[model samples]
Target: MLGFLTARQAGLDDPLRLRRAESTRRVLSLTLNPDRDVDRVHGNGVNAIDIDAVEGRYMLSGGADGVIVIYDLENFSGKPQYTCKAVCTVGRSSRHVHKFSVETVQWYPYDTGMFVSSSFDKTMKVWDTETLKPAEVFEFEDNVYSHHLSPIARKHSLIAVGTKNPKIQLCDLKSGSRIHVLQGHRAEVLAVRWSPRYEHILATASADSKVKVWDVRRASGSVLTLDQHNGDKSKASSEAVNTAHNGRVNGLCFTGDGLHLLTTGTDDRMRLWNSATGENTLVNYGKVCNESRKRLQFTVSRGCSPEFVFVPCGSSVAVYALHTGELVTMLRGHYNNVDCCEFHTDYQELYSGGKDCNILAWVPILRTADVEEESNSAPTRAVGQASVNPAFQDAWSSDED
Candidate 1:
């Protein structure tokens, strides 16, 4: 760590190199923080969560009880112990609240004044943040599973929505109507995401065990369908032809640059893919343990040397080396199954929600002065030593029950 600083001070290293090194170090030291907490605002499981890109200080969460909340993540009290308070909420008392489980919630990419949410009640609502009311509501015939708005789109205001119907719907915020539909999947569409790099490119995952990428401008059909076998005729069986997984694909997320895509499935597997060519990178993330019938929300870290992927695995959040498929650590806190996780890139923090009806904050531990002195003296101590936090130790016994 001192070597990188010295080289940076001497103008012998790229500034980005120092930044990446520090970011990677912080990610490796993440643990469930005992001081920081998020207020419990939902009566049921949290289905989705998102951090706003504009300020990164406000977080939005959707719950199975049809509640939505916005939390203030910034700590201004000059204290280490802080609880992120809910600034506002759309409670069940509100007439505009969804009638069923709120499946997905996302902030407007360019501004915080407007946001969107989709629900199992078969409607997607565009909300006015200040008013806490729906500005526009688009009704559908089937339950909505997931939806996404392009973060880099400058030429369009379309929201890609996945639902119980196989076809993906494109809703226009400008025209206040469903403008187009991309038809290809054979079962319920489980997840949808727009590329951060290109405005027109979109990806969709379905229960039929297929993932398809589309160029919405073409209006013909899907441009590519991910094949786990990499198009090898002999290795792929007839039933597995052009399938991304052996079961339902419930999660989809792109790396920060949108160059690669990560997916989770009911087959207890997660696969990485090359976004452009639709080729499976074949990096084996062993046994992700996904059993959700609805969309699972996961995320990736930005501005790190070797980027990391965070996915909800059972009751814990699994951190993996993005390119190498190495399991770095498991953040355990929730007692029930986890459903969603979001990375706060600027602060190097993580927030996860689960069926336990809790939102846990995972913060990086500060490097102690004693550890630094020991590292300087020994110069051979392993950097990846196991954590000594008592919360990490398992205490469950077979005789308890």
Candidate 2:
């Protein structure tokens, strides 16, 4: 660490190298935050969670009880020990509540005025954030498994939806109706995601053990189909030329930059792929226990040099190196199977929910000296003491009293 800092000071290393080092150190020190907790309001397990891109101050969660909640994550109390309280909730008594389990919930990318939720009741509802009333409802013939609105799309307001049926549905928020269907999978479509880099690109995973990437503007079939065998017919058996996993592919997420994609399946394996060429990176993220029959919501770190992937594995959330596929750590708190997790880039914090009916917050661990000094008036480092590691000294501010 000192060598990197010395090189940085001497103008020999890239400035990004220093930032990546700091980000890596912070990520490696993550621990469950005992002080911060999202208030519990769901009667059943939480299935989906999302933090909007605009502010990252508010969070949304949907649960099996057919309830949706919005939480104010900011600590306005001006103290270290402050709870993130629920701002508002759409409870079961509400006339607009879903009849069955809410499978997914996401905020509108551009604003907080509207959000979307899909449920097993075969309906996806768009709600006015202020009134908590359904502004638009799109009904499906089968149970809706997952839906995602492109976060970076400027030309389209399309929401890619997957259902119990093999066909993937694309609904346009502007038209308030189902615009088209992309068909290729032979079984239920369990997961769907839009490319953060390209507005026209979409990805879908299915029970048929296949993952396909499509271009919405093309009249032809998918642009690329991910093949675990990489088109090596000799090594491939009687199976199709393209198969992302050997079992049901239930989870899909793109990296922070949308350069690569990460997928998890019921096969107890997670694979990373090159989003452009559809080649499996073949980074072996060993047995990531996934048994969910529905869409599994996972997330990746943003604004970090070497990012990490957070996936729900059994009763714990497994954190792995995004590029190397190394299992960094396992967050074990939920008594039941964890279903979903969302990463907050602003503070390098993590929020997760599961069958335990609880949402747990994970924050980067602060040094003991700093924490102790903040708790009470204690002797910290002297004003003019030379530090053993110059990196800490360079990063630490000198304005403290």
Candidate 3:
């Protein structure tokens, strides 16, 4: 660590290298934090969570009980132990609250004054943050499963929405109306995501076992329907042609660069794909244990070397190395099945929500002086002792000892 700092100070090494190394180290050291907690505001499972891109200080969460909360993530008390308090909430009492499960929530990409949420109530509401009222509402005939606003969009103000309907709906924020529909999937569209790199590129996953990439500017059909077999005619059966998974693909996430895409399915599998070519990278993330019939929200790390992917696998959140598909660790905390998770890129922290009605924070343990000294003396021994934190140790009776 000191070597990198010395080189950085001497202007000999690229600053991004040091940043990546530290970020990677921080991610590897993450564990369920004992001191930090999110105020339990949900009576039902938390369905989605997102941190604001502008400040990264506030977090938005949607719950099964039709509640939406904004948490103040900035710890102004200058203490290690702090509970993230809900700054405001759209409770059941609110007239603007969803009538059913709030499936997805997201802060406006450029500002905190506006946000959006979708629900099984068959409506997507564009909200005014200060007034806690719906600025605009887009109603649909089917239950909304997922929705996404383009984070990099400058030319358009479109929000891509997935629903029980097979067609993907694109709502124009400027006109306050459903402007376009992209049709291809034969079943419910389970998930939709806009590319972080290109404003017009979008990806959708469906219960029909297909994942399709679209260029919204074109009036034609999908640009490419991802093929798990890489278009090998002999390998693909007739029924499996151009299918991304064998079952419902409920999750879709793009890597930071938007060059790669990750999809999770009910087939108990997660596949990585090349977004541009619609070719499966075939990175085998062995059985992910997905059982969710609705949209499953997962996230990928940003600003870290060898970025990691975080997915809810049963009752725990599983961390995997992006390219290698190696399981790095399982973050256990929730007592019930985890439904969603989000990475706080600025702080190198993670927040996950689950059926347990809890949102757990996973924080990185800072390197202590004693551990640093030990590592300098005997690196292997220090590495072995890393997990020996007293907080995680179990107590045993004298008889057992």
Candidate 4:
């Protein structure tokens, strides 16, 4: 009877149980907006890119064929159909050939002089802009899917890496040795992210269909395991287990404040979970198909009325209202399936990459007069900010609309 029940329950994912999660995310109807305000610039399908924090004048991208590109995103010319020229690339013949498709590239967060890239070849390298040479290289046992450096980690100089192996590795930037490993994931870990609020806190997603939050300082065990059901015995364990995802949990990200975690699964679902507890928030993003074996990079608008989540769905990039789970807008331009995306807070701008080998920029709809308005509309309370846990308040008042 136990075996019969297990087999029957394994085939189901209870929608009612999922709906009973502490919070139900809303889904917004997306009104396709033209990506006019920001420029659509890359010539090839872009693999990755990063925005400049200080100047806000330049952007950088890495391509599928191993081309690292830099673009000046400012409106240099008076015309609207502006072209973004290749500033420089590490170019061909460089040993940094990123043996397989370049998986992820990111800016150093604080400065423009350096950036980082991870590859299927099982390595992550820090690159110096001036020489385009690897400043630091860390090699791993299996393919590296994704890696992230904290945006504001001041004390611990560590980079979190997710590889084909089930373990999460922490490599020290200040030292050359691998500091520690966070284990428990039984399948290849796909994404690794650090909490903005807690310096030592890290989160990981895996092929095992579990999302685990860890404390890098502890060797004990995971702090939380994201379960689909709220540990309700009335539901079958299979139904409880399948709650998180039916496929690989490929992408994981925390909101700015570290209260909520966003996950994109190969099962065509995007879920919001409370960071403090592993409770699935049940904000239903209908079908977010993430086929990539690596992390599906998504971004949160730094300052907005209601925060937004930018996820790369199948062939296009889908923007969803963070907590409500509504699809706000789709930024279409890349002829191929979009892969990764990043957001800039100060200007409320977005950039995305796809298999079509191009990177597109998206921004709010602005007229000439609206563009000329010299008003700093930055959100006052970081409301609607894509924070990780349950703490960030919705800064934007829906009453205004």
Q: Against the hidden reference, what TM-scores do the models get?
A: 0.92, 0.91, 0.92, 0.79
- Writing each residue's lDDT as its tens digit, candidate 4 over 1-401 gives 23334444785644333332111122121212332333334445566777877787777776667666777776666555455566767656677757665677778878889888888778888888888889889998898888888877888888999899998889888896799888898899888888988888888889888888888778798888887666765663653463467678888878877888888888888888889988877787787767776667787765443567888877777777788887665655667888778776555667777777666655443333445663454221112222223222232112211
lDDT for 37 in candidate 1 is 86
Looking at model 2, report the run of 10 residues with the lowest lDDT sum.
379-388
Q: Which tens-of-lDDT digit does each residue in 1-401 have in candidate 2?
A: 56678888999988777677667666656667776778999999999999988998989999999999999999988667778999999998998999999999999998999999999999999999999999999999999999999999998899999999999999999999898999899999999999989989999999999999999999888999999989988877786568888899999999878889888999899999999999999898899999999999999987675688889999888888788887777787789999999999878888999998999988776666556757574323222111123333233322111
CA lDDT, every model vs. true structure: 0.90, 0.87, 0.90, 0.70
User: Candidate 3: minimum summed lDDT over ten consecutive residues — where?
Assistant: 391-400
Per the 3 Å backbone cut-off, how many clashing residue pairs does candidate 2 have? 0
Ten contiguous residues with the weakest lDDT in model 1: 392-401
Runs in model 2 deviating more than 4 A are 1-13, 372-401
lDDT string, candidate 1, 216-316, tens digits: 99969999999999999799889999999999999999999999999999999999999999999999889899989999999999998678999999999
Candidate 1 residue-wise lDDT at 334? 92
Model 3, span 189-255: residue lDDT tens: 9999999999999999999999999999999999989989999979988999999999999999999
Best by lDDT: 1
Q: Report how far residue 225 has shifted in candidate 1, in Å.
A: 0.4
